[model samples]
Target: MDGDIYKIVEQPLSPDAVAASVGDPAAGGVVIFSGIVRNEKDGRPVKYLEYEAHAAMAEAKMREIGAAVRQRWPSVKAVTMLHRIGRLEIGESSVLIAVSAAHRREAFEACQYAIDTLKQRVPVWKKEHFEDGEVWVGLQGG
Candidate 1:
């Protein structure tokens, strides 16, 4: 509740901005994770990607993740999670997560938890577009 940032937006997410949002004076370390769109998947050339989600519910789920992080790692000072929706080209970030804590280990672990939980629990859908065809996949994989 103190320092948690969660959002779902159509615009591109900036790693610097997400990290800045989680910056804290008491925090000794901050870890950021960016999930970007790659050029290929399963040996198939990917043209682009499109993401969609129930924005409000997605943000609420992110807040829940932050709460879980704080509960699991009390040292965590701040958390920020942003997921970008809509058409994204190769190399564009689809998700960004940042965590700040009293130590590097907690920050790293908390960031990992936030991302993994997000993929598993958040109701976001992903569409992979290829030159040949397109496929819809759940956020848990593909």
Candidate 2:
């Protein structure tokens, strides 16, 4: 809602799409953050990652984050938060956040805040699949 794109999808994520969603002719700068699945974690080799979420809740939280960004930085032109669920291979993007604003500083700050707050507040869980085993990652686990 609110004209901002906040979604959880099973399909692969596209950074370009996320960026495009926030494109604004009046905005001077655009900031994007692509959270890619890494090959290694804590010195262990990671084969892939599995992401699961209470989709409705996740999207709601994401929207809240976007709203917060807009509130904190009134100059923000547009904001988007897109996350991909299901299995993701190393080097693939799992999450993408884009922010467009009248200035670079506002775009950068809002984009950073969107992602950091999303990680801490969203109801999404990431499971790391290692060579030896798999583990759920979150505050109670990981």
What are the RMSDs of all candidates, in order?
2.1, 1.5
Where model 1 places Cα greater than 4 Å from the true spot, the runs are 139-142
Residue pairs that clash (backbone atoms under 3 angstroms), model 2: none
lDDT of 2 at 14: 83
Per-structure clash totals for the candidates = 0, 0
- Note the residue pairs that clash in candidate 1: none
lDDT of 1 at 98: 94
> Model 1: what TM-score?
0.95
Candidate 2 lDDT, 5-27, residue by residue in tens? 99999998887888888888889
**Alpha carbon lDDT at 47, candidate 2:** 100
lDDT of 1 by residue, 52-110 (tens): 99999999999999999999999999999999999999999999999999999999999
Candidate 1 achieves a global lDDT of: 0.93
